[model samples]
Target: MIFDPSPIELPSSYEKVETTGHVFVSHYPPGTPAVTPVVIVTLNRPAKHNAFTPQMVRDFEKLFPMFDVDERVKVVVLTGAGKTFCAGADLEIGFGVGKDRTADHRDGGGRVALAIHRCRKPTIVAMQGSAVGVGMTMTLPAIIRIGYEKGKYGFVFGRRGIVLESCSSYFLPRLVGHSNASYLVSTGGVFPPTSKHFGDLFNEILPDASQVLPRALELATEIAENVSPASSYLNRALMWRDTGSAEAAHLIESRVINHMFGSEDQKEGVAAFFEKRKPNFKANLDDNPPPSVPWWTEIDTGRSPKAKGPSKL
Candidate 1:
Protein backbone atom coordinates (compact mmCIF):
# COMPACT_ATOMS: atom_id res chain seq x y z
CA MET A 1 0.00 0.00 0.00
CA ILE A 2 1.29 3.46 -0.81
CA PHE A 3 1.54 5.64 2.33
CA ASP A 4 0.40 9.24 2.04
CA PRO A 5 3.26 11.72 2.55
CA SER A 6 1.20 14.79 3.40
CA PRO A 7 1.88 16.04 6.93
CA ILE A 8 -0.55 16.53 9.81
CA GLU A 9 -0.79 19.20 12.52
CA LEU A 10 2.07 18.81 15.01
CA PRO A 11 3.90 20.74 17.66
CA SER A 12 6.72 23.02 16.44
CA SER A 13 9.41 20.66 17.71
CA TYR A 14 7.78 17.56 16.18
CA GLU A 15 7.27 19.45 12.92
CA LYS A 16 11.03 20.10 12.82
CA VAL A 17 11.76 16.37 13.16
CA GLU A 18 9.26 15.54 10.41
CA THR A 19 10.89 18.13 8.14
CA THR A 20 14.23 16.29 8.51
CA GLY A 21 12.96 13.69 5.98
CA HIS A 22 14.55 10.84 7.94
CA VAL A 23 11.10 9.58 8.87
CA PHE A 24 7.55 10.29 7.69
CA VAL A 25 4.92 11.34 10.21
CA SER A 26 1.16 11.75 9.73
CA HIS A 27 -2.03 11.53 11.76
CA TYR A 28 -4.33 8.76 10.59
CA PRO A 29 -7.97 9.49 9.97
CA PRO A 30 -9.91 7.29 12.35
CA GLY A 31 -12.90 5.21 11.29
CA THR A 32 -16.35 5.24 12.83
CA PRO A 33 -16.52 5.32 16.63
CA ALA A 34 -12.73 5.92 16.75
CA VAL A 35 -11.09 9.23 17.69
CA THR A 36 -8.85 11.47 15.63
CA PRO A 37 -5.04 11.84 15.55
CA VAL A 38 -3.57 8.38 15.68
CA VAL A 39 -0.01 9.18 14.54
CA ILE A 40 1.76 7.14 11.86
CA VAL A 41 5.58 7.22 11.72
CA THR A 42 7.40 5.65 8.79
CA LEU A 43 11.08 5.27 8.07
CA ASN A 44 11.78 7.16 4.83
CA ARG A 45 14.89 5.28 3.66
CA PRO A 46 13.40 2.86 1.16
CA ALA A 47 16.51 3.19 -0.99
CA LYS A 48 18.57 1.82 1.87
CA HIS A 49 15.82 -0.50 3.14
CA ASN A 50 15.52 1.77 6.17
CA ALA A 51 18.93 0.90 7.58
CA PHE A 52 19.74 2.03 11.08
CA THR A 53 22.10 4.98 11.49
CA PRO A 54 23.12 7.52 14.10
CA GLN A 55 20.90 10.07 12.39
CA MET A 56 17.94 7.67 12.64
CA VAL A 57 18.69 7.29 16.33
CA ARG A 58 18.69 11.06 16.82
CA ASP A 59 15.42 11.36 14.88
CA PHE A 60 13.61 8.76 16.98
CA GLU A 61 14.95 10.36 20.18
CA LYS A 62 13.24 13.57 19.21
CA LEU A 63 10.20 11.94 17.60
CA PHE A 64 8.84 9.43 20.13
CA PRO A 65 9.09 11.69 23.16
CA MET A 66 7.01 14.24 21.34
CA PHE A 67 4.40 11.55 20.66
CA ASP A 68 4.43 10.54 24.31
CA VAL A 69 3.75 14.04 25.67
CA ASP A 70 1.47 15.38 22.97
CA GLU A 71 -2.19 15.13 23.93
CA ARG A 72 -3.26 15.11 20.28
CA VAL A 73 -1.41 11.88 19.56
CA LYS A 74 -3.42 8.85 20.69
CA VAL A 75 -1.18 6.00 19.51
CA VAL A 76 2.03 5.79 17.48
CA VAL A 77 2.11 3.44 14.50
CA LEU A 78 5.53 2.62 12.97
CA THR A 79 6.39 1.15 9.60
CA GLY A 80 8.84 1.57 6.74
CA ALA A 81 8.76 2.77 3.16
CA GLY A 82 8.85 0.38 0.16
CA LYS A 83 8.91 -3.39 0.46
CA THR A 84 11.68 -3.78 3.04
CA PHE A 85 11.18 -2.67 6.63
CA CYS A 86 14.83 -2.37 7.67
CA ALA A 87 18.05 -4.12 6.65
CA GLY A 88 19.67 -3.65 10.05
CA ALA A 89 22.57 -1.22 10.49
CA ASP A 90 24.31 0.24 7.45
CA LEU A 91 27.59 -1.60 8.13
CA GLU A 92 29.36 0.45 5.46
CA ILE A 93 29.16 3.47 7.74
CA GLY A 94 29.93 1.37 10.82
CA PHE A 95 28.50 2.38 14.24
CA GLY A 96 29.49 4.90 16.85
CA VAL A 97 33.29 5.10 16.40
CA GLY A 98 34.15 7.81 18.87
CA LYS A 99 37.29 7.87 20.98
CA ASP A 100 35.08 7.89 24.09
CA ARG A 101 35.68 4.93 26.37
CA THR A 102 33.66 1.78 25.71
CA ALA A 103 31.90 2.55 28.96
CA ASP A 104 30.87 6.00 27.70
CA HIS A 105 29.73 5.05 24.19
CA ARG A 106 26.02 4.25 24.20
CA ASP A 107 24.56 1.79 21.69
CA GLY A 108 22.64 3.83 19.13
CA GLY A 109 20.03 1.08 18.79
CA GLY A 110 19.73 0.82 22.56
CA ARG A 111 19.19 4.56 22.88
CA VAL A 112 16.28 4.39 20.42
CA ALA A 113 15.03 1.23 22.12
CA LEU A 114 14.80 3.01 25.43
CA ALA A 115 13.08 6.00 23.88
CA ILE A 116 10.34 3.72 22.54
CA HIS A 117 10.23 1.75 25.78
CA ARG A 118 9.87 4.77 28.03
CA CYS A 119 7.43 6.67 25.88
CA ARG A 120 4.03 6.85 27.57
CA LYS A 121 2.21 6.56 24.24
CA PRO A 122 1.77 2.96 23.22
CA THR A 123 3.50 1.96 19.95
CA ILE A 124 2.61 -0.57 17.28
CA VAL A 125 5.24 -1.58 14.69
CA ALA A 126 4.25 -2.92 11.27
CA MET A 127 7.20 -4.90 9.97
CA GLN A 128 5.99 -4.91 6.37
CA GLY A 129 9.20 -6.61 5.25
CA SER A 130 12.24 -8.37 6.59
CA ALA A 131 13.91 -7.08 9.78
CA VAL A 132 17.33 -8.17 10.88
CA GLY A 133 19.74 -7.46 13.76
CA VAL A 134 19.14 -3.94 15.05
CA GLY A 135 15.98 -3.66 13.03
CA MET A 136 14.52 -6.64 14.88
CA THR A 137 15.98 -5.91 18.31
CA MET A 138 15.20 -2.20 18.43
CA THR A 139 11.51 -2.81 17.71
CA LEU A 140 11.23 -5.22 20.64
CA PRO A 141 10.47 -2.23 22.82
CA ALA A 142 7.19 -1.52 21.07
CA ILE A 143 4.03 -2.73 22.84
CA ILE A 144 2.74 -4.53 19.74
CA ARG A 145 4.34 -5.77 16.53
CA ILE A 146 2.72 -7.02 13.34
CA GLY A 147 4.96 -8.72 10.78
CA TYR A 148 4.65 -10.02 7.26
CA GLU A 149 4.61 -13.81 7.25
CA LYS A 150 6.98 -13.82 4.27
CA GLY A 151 9.56 -11.56 5.94
CA LYS A 152 12.75 -12.73 7.63
CA TYR A 153 13.64 -11.97 11.26
CA GLY A 154 16.70 -12.73 13.38
CA PHE A 155 18.94 -11.98 16.32
CA VAL A 156 22.04 -11.81 14.13
CA PHE A 157 24.51 -10.18 16.51
CA GLY A 158 26.34 -13.46 17.17
CA ARG A 159 26.98 -13.82 13.46
CA ARG A 160 28.11 -10.20 13.28
CA GLY A 161 30.78 -10.79 15.98
CA ILE A 162 29.02 -8.39 18.33
CA VAL A 163 26.75 -8.91 21.31
CA LEU A 164 23.11 -7.83 21.30
CA GLU A 165 22.47 -4.09 21.40
CA SER A 166 19.05 -2.47 21.99
CA CYS A 167 18.81 -4.35 25.32
CA SER A 168 17.49 -7.33 23.38
CA SER A 169 19.31 -9.50 25.91
CA TYR A 170 16.59 -8.43 28.33
CA PHE A 171 13.60 -7.88 26.06
CA LEU A 172 14.10 -10.92 23.84
CA PRO A 173 14.10 -13.41 26.67
CA ARG A 174 11.19 -11.78 28.46
CA LEU A 175 9.21 -11.51 25.23
CA VAL A 176 9.60 -15.09 24.09
CA GLY A 177 11.39 -17.08 26.79
CA HIS A 178 14.92 -17.89 27.90
CA SER A 179 15.08 -21.09 25.83
CA ASN A 180 13.58 -19.54 22.70
CA ALA A 181 15.78 -16.49 23.06
CA SER A 182 18.81 -18.75 23.42
CA TYR A 183 18.04 -20.69 20.24
CA LEU A 184 17.53 -17.55 18.12
CA VAL A 185 20.66 -15.74 19.33
CA SER A 186 22.81 -18.85 19.24
CA THR A 187 21.95 -19.58 15.64
CA GLY A 188 22.20 -15.88 14.66
CA GLY A 189 20.32 -17.05 11.58
CA VAL A 190 17.47 -15.42 9.74
CA PHE A 191 14.13 -17.21 9.78
CA PRO A 192 10.59 -16.57 8.59
CA PRO A 193 7.84 -15.43 10.96
CA THR A 194 6.46 -18.96 10.92
CA SER A 195 9.68 -20.18 12.61
CA LYS A 196 8.86 -21.70 15.95
CA HIS A 197 11.88 -19.99 17.52
CA PHE A 198 10.13 -16.61 17.21
CA GLY A 199 7.36 -17.84 19.51
CA ASP A 200 5.37 -14.83 20.82
CA LEU A 201 7.48 -11.99 19.48
CA PHE A 202 4.99 -11.11 16.78
CA ASN A 203 1.42 -10.43 17.76
CA GLU A 204 0.25 -11.23 14.24
CA ILE A 205 1.90 -12.16 10.97
CA LEU A 206 -0.07 -11.26 7.87
CA PRO A 207 0.22 -13.17 4.60
CA ASP A 208 0.93 -9.98 2.66
CA ALA A 209 3.06 -6.92 3.32
CA SER A 210 0.23 -4.74 2.05
CA GLN A 211 -1.96 -5.83 4.95
CA VAL A 212 0.51 -4.98 7.69
CA LEU A 213 -0.08 -1.24 8.10
CA PRO A 214 -3.84 -1.40 7.62
CA ARG A 215 -4.22 -4.07 10.29
CA ALA A 216 -2.05 -2.03 12.61
CA LEU A 217 -4.15 1.05 11.96
CA GLU A 218 -7.35 -0.89 12.68
CA LEU A 219 -5.94 -1.92 16.06
CA ALA A 220 -4.65 1.57 16.78
CA THR A 221 -8.03 3.11 16.04
CA GLU A 222 -9.77 0.69 18.38
CA ILE A 223 -7.32 1.62 21.13
CA ALA A 224 -7.70 5.33 20.43
CA GLU A 225 -11.45 5.13 20.78
CA ASN A 226 -12.48 2.56 23.37
CA VAL A 227 -9.42 2.43 25.62
CA SER A 228 -8.10 4.74 28.28
CA PRO A 229 -4.56 5.86 27.42
CA ALA A 230 -3.54 6.07 31.09
CA SER A 231 -4.86 2.59 31.75
CA SER A 232 -3.14 1.09 28.71
CA TYR A 233 0.29 2.49 29.58
CA LEU A 234 -0.02 1.67 33.28
CA ASN A 235 -1.03 -1.93 32.55
CA ARG A 236 2.01 -2.48 30.33
CA ALA A 237 4.31 -0.82 32.88
CA LEU A 238 2.84 -3.00 35.61
CA MET A 239 3.54 -6.10 33.56
CA TRP A 240 7.09 -5.13 32.52
CA ARG A 241 8.13 -3.53 35.82
CA ASP A 242 6.13 -4.59 38.83
CA THR A 243 6.49 -4.48 42.59
CA GLY A 244 8.42 -6.78 44.94
CA SER A 245 5.77 -9.25 46.04
CA ALA A 246 2.20 -10.37 45.42
CA GLU A 247 1.14 -8.23 48.35
CA ALA A 248 2.81 -5.15 46.87
CA ALA A 249 1.30 -5.84 43.48
CA HIS A 250 -2.13 -6.15 45.01
CA LEU A 251 -1.72 -2.92 46.94
CA ILE A 252 -0.45 -1.04 43.94
CA GLU A 253 -3.24 -2.29 41.73
CA SER A 254 -5.78 -1.55 44.41
CA ARG A 255 -4.64 2.06 44.70
CA VAL A 256 -4.73 2.43 40.95
CA ILE A 257 -8.13 0.78 40.66
CA ASN A 258 -9.51 3.04 43.34
CA HIS A 259 -8.38 6.09 41.37
CA MET A 260 -9.84 4.67 38.15
CA PHE A 261 -13.14 3.81 39.77
CA GLY A 262 -13.76 7.51 40.36
CA SER A 263 -12.18 8.80 37.13
CA GLU A 264 -14.17 10.29 34.26
CA ASP A 265 -13.01 7.48 32.01
CA GLN A 266 -14.47 4.92 34.38
CA LYS A 267 -17.84 6.56 34.19
CA GLU A 268 -17.64 6.88 30.43
CA GLY A 269 -16.67 3.24 30.06
CA VAL A 270 -19.62 2.06 32.08
CA ALA A 271 -22.00 4.37 30.26
CA ALA A 272 -20.75 3.24 26.90
CA PHE A 273 -21.22 -0.38 27.89
CA PHE A 274 -24.80 0.19 28.98
CA GLU A 275 -25.64 2.37 26.01
CA LYS A 276 -23.98 0.08 23.48
CA ARG A 277 -21.89 2.96 22.27
CA LYS A 278 -18.19 3.52 21.81
CA PRO A 279 -16.31 5.24 24.63
CA ASN A 280 -14.44 8.47 24.09
CA PHE A 281 -11.68 8.03 26.62
CA LYS A 282 -9.73 11.23 27.19
CA ALA A 283 -7.30 10.28 29.94
CA ASN A 284 -3.80 11.30 28.90
CA LEU A 285 -0.87 9.59 30.58
CA ASP A 286 0.79 12.90 31.41
CA ASP A 287 -2.29 14.42 32.98
CA ASN A 288 -4.22 11.41 34.31
CA PRO A 289 -1.65 8.79 35.31
CA PRO A 290 -2.44 6.41 38.12
CA PRO A 291 -0.62 6.89 41.42
CA SER A 292 2.58 5.06 42.49
CA VAL A 293 3.86 4.66 38.94
CA PRO A 294 7.61 4.13 38.62
CA TRP A 295 7.20 2.18 41.84
CA TRP A 296 9.96 -0.16 40.78
CA THR A 297 13.56 0.83 41.40
CA GLU A 298 14.64 2.96 38.46
CA ILE A 299 17.79 2.02 36.68
CA ASP A 300 19.24 4.93 34.80
CA THR A 301 18.56 4.52 31.08
CA GLY A 302 22.20 5.56 30.62
CA ARG A 303 23.17 2.15 32.08
CA SER A 304 24.37 3.74 35.30
CA PRO A 305 24.27 1.73 38.53
CA LYS A 306 22.67 4.50 40.56
CA ALA A 307 19.00 4.29 41.51
CA LYS A 308 16.84 7.35 41.03
CA GLY A 309 13.24 6.66 41.99
CA PRO A 310 10.81 4.28 43.58
CA SER A 311 8.43 7.20 43.51
CA LYS A 312 5.56 8.61 41.47
CA LEU A 313 5.97 9.19 37.73
Candidate 2:
Protein backbone atom coordinates (compact mmCIF):
# COMPACT_ATOMS: atom_id res chain seq x y z
CA MET A 1 0.00 0.00 0.00
CA ILE A 2 1.28 3.46 -0.89
CA PHE A 3 1.38 6.27 1.70
CA ASP A 4 1.08 10.04 1.31
CA PRO A 5 4.67 10.89 2.16
CA SER A 6 4.14 14.58 2.86
CA PRO A 7 6.59 16.54 5.01
CA ILE A 8 5.46 17.24 8.52
CA GLU A 9 7.53 19.55 10.73
CA LEU A 10 9.99 17.67 12.93
CA PRO A 11 9.92 18.52 16.64
CA SER A 12 13.25 20.20 16.13
CA SER A 13 14.98 21.32 12.92
CA TYR A 14 16.49 18.11 11.65
CA GLU A 15 16.67 20.15 8.46
CA LYS A 16 20.12 21.61 7.84
CA VAL A 17 20.71 24.37 5.29
CA GLU A 18 22.94 22.27 3.04
CA THR A 19 24.55 18.81 2.92
CA THR A 20 22.04 16.01 3.52
CA GLY A 21 18.44 15.71 2.38
CA HIS A 22 15.79 18.11 3.73
CA VAL A 23 14.17 15.68 6.14
CA PHE A 24 10.39 15.09 6.24
CA VAL A 25 8.41 12.79 8.48
CA SER A 26 5.55 10.90 6.79
CA HIS A 27 3.76 9.16 9.63
CA TYR A 28 3.58 9.70 13.34
CA PRO A 29 3.47 6.80 15.78
CA PRO A 30 0.35 6.48 17.90
CA GLY A 31 0.69 8.06 21.39
CA THR A 32 3.86 8.59 23.50
CA PRO A 33 6.52 10.34 21.37
CA ALA A 34 7.77 8.19 18.44
CA VAL A 35 8.27 10.67 15.55
CA THR A 36 7.75 8.64 12.40
CA PRO A 37 8.84 5.43 10.76
CA VAL A 38 9.78 6.66 7.27
CA VAL A 39 11.41 9.96 6.28
CA ILE A 40 11.88 11.64 2.91
CA VAL A 41 15.17 13.50 2.46
CA THR A 42 15.12 16.01 -0.39
CA LEU A 43 18.14 17.38 -2.19
CA ASN A 44 16.87 20.96 -2.00
CA ARG A 45 18.82 22.84 -4.67
CA PRO A 46 16.38 23.03 -7.52
CA ALA A 47 17.68 26.24 -9.15
CA LYS A 48 21.14 24.91 -9.80
CA HIS A 49 19.82 21.50 -10.70
CA ASN A 50 20.38 20.39 -7.12
CA ALA A 51 24.14 20.45 -7.64
CA PHE A 52 26.27 19.24 -4.74
CA THR A 53 28.17 21.72 -2.59
CA PRO A 54 30.74 21.75 0.26
CA GLN A 55 28.16 22.81 2.86
CA MET A 56 25.93 20.01 1.56
CA VAL A 57 28.72 17.56 2.19
CA ARG A 58 29.20 18.83 5.73
CA ASP A 59 25.44 18.62 6.30
CA PHE A 60 25.32 14.99 5.16
CA GLU A 61 28.27 14.16 7.41
CA LYS A 62 26.13 15.21 10.36
CA LEU A 63 22.73 14.14 9.01
CA PHE A 64 23.46 10.47 8.28
CA PRO A 65 24.72 9.71 11.80
CA MET A 66 21.50 11.16 13.23
CA PHE A 67 19.52 8.85 10.96
CA ASP A 68 21.80 5.97 11.90
CA VAL A 69 21.11 6.30 15.62
CA ASP A 70 17.52 7.58 15.62
CA GLU A 71 15.20 4.75 16.56
CA ARG A 72 12.34 6.78 15.06
CA VAL A 73 13.82 6.57 11.58
CA LYS A 74 13.37 3.01 10.33
CA VAL A 75 13.66 3.71 6.59
CA VAL A 76 14.94 6.71 4.63
CA VAL A 77 13.95 7.98 1.15
CA LEU A 78 16.28 10.37 -0.67
CA THR A 79 14.93 12.55 -3.48
CA GLY A 80 15.54 15.89 -5.15
CA ALA A 81 13.43 19.06 -4.85
CA GLY A 82 12.77 19.65 -8.54
CA LYS A 83 13.03 18.28 -12.04
CA THR A 84 16.71 17.47 -11.98
CA PHE A 85 18.05 15.40 -9.14
CA CYS A 86 21.55 16.85 -9.25
CA ALA A 87 23.66 18.17 -12.12
CA GLY A 88 26.91 17.23 -10.29
CA ALA A 89 29.18 19.15 -7.95
CA ASP A 90 28.76 22.91 -8.03
CA LEU A 91 32.12 23.94 -9.52
CA GLU A 92 31.41 27.68 -9.34
CA ILE A 93 33.99 27.84 -6.54
CA GLY A 94 35.83 24.93 -8.14
CA PHE A 95 36.05 21.34 -6.85
CA GLY A 96 38.11 20.58 -3.76
CA VAL A 97 40.07 23.80 -4.19
CA GLY A 98 40.86 23.81 -0.50
CA LYS A 99 43.91 24.90 1.50
CA ASP A 100 44.23 21.45 3.07
CA ARG A 101 47.17 19.36 1.88
CA THR A 102 46.36 16.64 -0.67
CA ALA A 103 47.62 13.95 1.72
CA ASP A 104 45.21 15.00 4.46
CA HIS A 105 42.26 15.84 2.20
CA ARG A 106 39.37 13.40 2.13
CA ASP A 107 36.88 13.59 -0.74
CA GLY A 108 33.84 15.21 0.88
CA GLY A 109 31.43 13.20 -1.25
CA GLY A 110 33.15 9.98 -0.17
CA ARG A 111 32.67 10.97 3.45
CA VAL A 112 28.90 11.37 2.85
CA ALA A 113 28.87 8.01 1.07
CA LEU A 114 30.54 6.30 4.02
CA ALA A 115 28.09 7.84 6.49
CA ILE A 116 25.16 6.62 4.39
CA HIS A 117 26.65 3.13 4.20
CA ARG A 118 27.14 2.95 7.96
CA CYS A 119 23.48 3.88 8.50
CA ARG A 120 21.68 0.65 9.40
CA LYS A 121 18.19 1.78 8.33
CA PRO A 122 17.07 0.64 4.89
CA THR A 123 17.60 3.53 2.45
CA ILE A 124 15.96 4.26 -0.89
CA VAL A 125 17.09 6.82 -3.46
CA ALA A 126 14.35 8.53 -5.45
CA MET A 127 15.95 9.80 -8.63
CA GLN A 128 13.02 12.03 -9.57
CA GLY A 129 14.89 13.36 -12.59
CA SER A 130 18.29 13.41 -14.29
CA ALA A 131 21.49 13.00 -12.29
CA VAL A 132 25.13 13.38 -13.25
CA GLY A 133 28.64 12.71 -11.90
CA VAL A 134 28.79 12.70 -8.08
CA GLY A 135 25.07 13.35 -8.18
CA MET A 136 24.54 9.85 -9.54
CA THR A 137 27.34 8.12 -7.66
CA MET A 138 26.24 9.31 -4.21
CA THR A 139 23.03 7.28 -4.28
CA LEU A 140 24.78 4.00 -5.14
CA PRO A 141 25.03 3.19 -1.45
CA ALA A 142 21.26 3.01 -1.04
CA ILE A 143 19.65 -0.43 -0.80
CA ILE A 144 17.09 0.45 -3.48
CA ARG A 145 17.21 3.12 -6.21
CA ILE A 146 14.17 4.25 -8.17
CA GLY A 147 14.80 6.26 -11.30
CA TYR A 148 12.77 8.20 -13.86
CA GLU A 149 12.53 6.49 -17.22
CA LYS A 150 13.60 9.53 -19.21
CA GLY A 151 16.28 10.85 -16.87
CA LYS A 152 19.81 11.12 -18.28
CA TYR A 153 22.57 9.73 -16.05
CA GLY A 154 26.34 9.47 -16.36
CA PHE A 155 29.58 8.88 -14.47
CA VAL A 156 30.74 12.18 -16.10
CA PHE A 157 34.10 12.50 -14.23
CA GLY A 158 36.22 11.69 -17.28
CA ARG A 159 34.60 14.56 -19.17
CA ARG A 160 35.33 16.86 -16.23
CA GLY A 161 38.97 15.61 -16.13
CA ILE A 162 38.40 14.11 -12.65
CA VAL A 163 38.01 10.63 -11.20
CA LEU A 164 35.03 8.96 -9.53
CA GLU A 165 34.23 10.01 -5.94
CA SER A 166 31.66 8.91 -3.32
CA CYS A 167 33.41 5.52 -3.07
CA SER A 168 31.80 4.54 -6.37
CA SER A 169 35.02 2.61 -7.00
CA TYR A 170 33.83 0.11 -4.38
CA PHE A 171 30.05 0.24 -4.94
CA LEU A 172 29.63 0.71 -8.72
CA PRO A 173 31.73 -2.27 -9.70
CA ARG A 174 29.93 -4.49 -7.20
CA LEU A 175 26.46 -3.22 -8.23
CA VAL A 176 26.93 -3.27 -12.01
CA GLY A 177 30.18 -5.25 -12.48
CA HIS A 178 33.64 -3.98 -13.52
CA SER A 179 32.84 -3.93 -17.22
CA ASN A 180 29.75 -1.72 -16.80
CA ALA A 181 31.58 0.59 -14.40
CA SER A 182 34.48 0.84 -16.83
CA TYR A 183 32.18 1.60 -19.74
CA LEU A 184 30.31 4.35 -17.89
CA VAL A 185 33.47 5.95 -16.50
CA SER A 186 35.74 5.38 -19.48
CA THR A 187 33.28 6.99 -21.89
CA GLY A 188 31.80 9.46 -19.39
CA GLY A 189 28.66 9.55 -21.46
CA VAL A 190 25.13 10.36 -20.30
CA PHE A 191 22.66 7.60 -20.89
CA PRO A 192 19.13 6.85 -19.83
CA PRO A 193 18.81 4.73 -16.68
CA THR A 194 17.29 2.10 -19.02
CA SER A 195 20.56 1.84 -20.96
CA LYS A 196 21.98 -1.65 -21.19
CA HIS A 197 25.13 -0.39 -19.48
CA PHE A 198 23.50 0.24 -16.07
CA GLY A 199 22.73 -3.46 -15.35
CA ASP A 200 20.90 -3.65 -12.03
CA LEU A 201 22.15 -0.24 -10.92
CA PHE A 202 18.57 1.01 -10.81
CA ASN A 203 16.23 -1.40 -9.12
CA GLU A 204 13.24 0.08 -10.95
CA ILE A 205 12.96 2.75 -13.61
CA LEU A 206 9.45 4.19 -13.70
CA PRO A 207 7.67 5.52 -16.79
CA ASP A 208 7.55 9.10 -15.47
CA ALA A 209 9.53 11.42 -13.21
CA SER A 210 6.57 12.15 -10.95
CA GLN A 211 6.35 8.50 -9.98
CA VAL A 212 9.85 8.20 -8.56
CA LEU A 213 9.39 9.67 -5.06
CA PRO A 214 6.04 8.01 -4.46
CA ARG A 215 7.42 4.61 -5.35
CA ALA A 216 10.42 5.17 -3.13
CA LEU A 217 8.13 6.15 -0.26
CA GLU A 218 6.03 3.07 -0.88
CA LEU A 219 9.08 0.84 -0.65
CA ALA A 220 10.30 2.69 2.44
CA THR A 221 6.92 2.35 4.12
CA GLU A 222 6.85 -1.36 3.33
CA ILE A 223 10.18 -1.94 4.98
CA ALA A 224 9.39 0.35 7.91
CA GLU A 225 6.04 -1.23 8.66
CA ASN A 226 6.63 -4.95 8.19
CA VAL A 227 10.32 -5.83 7.90
CA SER A 228 12.60 -6.43 10.85
CA PRO A 229 15.09 -3.55 10.93
CA ALA A 230 17.83 -5.65 12.55
CA SER A 231 17.34 -8.52 10.12
CA SER A 232 17.33 -6.20 7.11
CA TYR A 233 20.48 -4.40 8.22
CA LEU A 234 22.32 -7.65 8.91
CA ASN A 235 21.36 -9.06 5.51
CA ARG A 236 22.70 -5.91 3.78
CA ALA A 237 25.89 -6.09 5.87
CA LEU A 238 26.40 -9.76 4.96
CA MET A 239 26.30 -8.82 1.28
CA TRP A 240 28.27 -5.56 1.41
CA ARG A 241 30.67 -6.66 4.14
CA ASP A 242 31.58 -10.03 2.76
CA THR A 243 33.91 -12.53 4.44
CA GLY A 244 36.57 -13.90 2.05
CA SER A 245 36.02 -17.61 2.43
CA ALA A 246 32.81 -19.64 2.32
CA GLU A 247 33.65 -21.27 5.65
CA ALA A 248 34.05 -17.86 7.21
CA ALA A 249 30.75 -16.73 5.71
CA HIS A 250 29.10 -19.85 7.06
CA LEU A 251 30.54 -19.28 10.52
CA ILE A 252 29.40 -15.68 10.69
CA GLU A 253 26.02 -16.51 9.21
CA SER A 254 25.58 -19.30 11.75
CA ARG A 255 26.41 -16.99 14.60
CA VAL A 256 24.09 -14.23 13.34
CA ILE A 257 21.28 -16.61 12.46
CA ASN A 258 21.45 -18.28 15.86
CA HIS A 259 21.30 -14.94 17.60
CA MET A 260 18.48 -13.67 15.35
CA PHE A 261 16.52 -16.87 15.84
CA GLY A 262 16.30 -16.05 19.51
CA SER A 263 15.71 -12.31 18.96
CA GLU A 264 12.48 -10.43 19.72
CA ASP A 265 11.69 -9.86 16.05
CA GLN A 266 11.77 -13.57 15.34
CA LYS A 267 9.27 -14.24 18.09
CA GLU A 268 7.08 -11.39 16.92
CA GLY A 269 7.28 -12.58 13.33
CA VAL A 270 6.33 -16.11 14.29
CA ALA A 271 3.52 -14.95 16.50
CA ALA A 272 2.19 -12.67 13.76
CA PHE A 273 2.30 -15.54 11.30
CA PHE A 274 0.26 -17.70 13.66
CA GLU A 275 -2.10 -14.89 14.61
CA LYS A 276 -2.67 -13.68 11.05
CA ARG A 277 -1.82 -10.11 11.98
CA LYS A 278 0.95 -7.69 11.01
CA PRO A 279 4.10 -8.11 13.09
CA ASN A 280 5.31 -5.04 14.91
CA PHE A 281 9.03 -5.78 15.07
CA LYS A 282 10.34 -3.52 17.85
CA ALA A 283 14.04 -4.13 17.35
CA ASN A 284 15.94 -0.92 16.60
CA LEU A 285 19.46 -1.32 15.17
CA ASP A 286 21.01 1.34 17.40
CA ASP A 287 19.57 -0.13 20.56
CA ASN A 288 20.37 -3.77 19.70
CA PRO A 289 22.80 -4.75 16.98
CA PRO A 290 23.21 -8.41 16.10
CA PRO A 291 26.23 -10.35 17.42
CA SER A 292 29.48 -9.76 15.54
CA VAL A 293 27.83 -6.72 13.93
CA PRO A 294 30.91 -5.05 12.52
CA TRP A 295 32.42 -8.42 11.65
CA TRP A 296 34.95 -6.55 9.49
CA THR A 297 37.87 -4.36 10.48
CA GLU A 298 36.47 -0.84 10.87
CA ILE A 299 38.48 1.73 8.95
CA ASP A 300 39.18 5.12 10.50
CA THR A 301 38.16 7.33 7.60
CA GLY A 302 38.31 10.49 9.70
CA ARG A 303 41.92 10.12 10.89
CA SER A 304 43.94 12.98 9.37
CA PRO A 305 47.44 13.57 10.67
CA LYS A 306 48.28 17.18 11.31
CA ALA A 307 50.55 18.15 8.43
CA LYS A 308 53.66 20.07 9.45
CA GLY A 309 54.02 23.38 7.61
CA PRO A 310 57.28 24.08 5.77
CA SER A 311 58.07 26.77 8.35
CA LYS A 312 57.55 24.35 11.24
CA LEU A 313 59.48 21.59 9.50
Best candidate, lDDT:
1
lDDT of each: 0.80, 0.78
Q: What is the lDDT of candidate 1?
A: 0.80
Candidate 2 lDDT tens digits, 80-99: 88899989988885785667
Poorest 10 consecutive residues by lDDT, candidate 2: 304-313
Worst 10 residues of 1 by lDDT: 304-313
CA shift of 286, model 1, Å: 2.6
**TM-scores of all models?**
0.87, 0.87
Clashing pairs in 2: 19-56
Model 1 TM-score relative to the real fold: 0.87
Residue 177 of model 2, lDDT score: 94
Shift in Å, residue 127, candidate 1: 0.5
Instruction: List candidate 1 segments past 4 Å from native.
Output: 1-19, 30-36, 302-313
Q: In every candidate, how many clashes are there?
A: 0, 1
